[model samples]
Target: MAVPKRKTSKASKRTRRTHQKASSNAVSYDSVLGVYKRSHYISPDGYYKGRKVID
Candidate 1:
């Protein structure tokens, strides 16, 4: 088993753990549907990039 030679500092541990948490998705307001949805993603109603993709 490999062992670490030096103990990790608080800043180092926190810096590594900074991205370990869940990130919130960005939202955008749809003028056509009049609802808030995830940015750059298709809505559940099947719309993408401000246009209907599927029914």
Candidate 2:
């Protein structure tokens, strides 16, 4: 009971969904602990690329 005998235009369904879009995680925006984070991790009061490595 299959279908789809040919009718998926729209640039081949957006080029096969181009990886299915919709993706996040990788924030990055903490000027010395001022907001957002996640890029290379390390910021929960520990800091990393912003110096002050735990301590």
**Candidate closest to the true structure, highest TM-score:** 1
* Candidate 2: residue 4 lDDT (0-100): 93
Model 1, TM vs. native: 0.60
Give lDDT tens digits, candidate 2, residues 1-55. Answer: 9999999999999998899778878797889878888898887788888898887
Q: What C-alpha lDDT values do all the predictions have?
A: 0.90, 0.86
Cα lDDT for residue 55, model 1? Answer: 87
lDDT of 1 by residue, 8-35 (tens): 9999999999989988999999987899
Clashes of 2: 0
**How far is each candidate from the true structure, as Cα RMSD in Å?**
2.6, 6.1
Off by over 4 Å in 2: 1-8, 18-20, 26-36, 39-46, 49-55
Q: What is the C-alpha RMSD, rounded to one decimal, of candidate 2?
A: 6.1
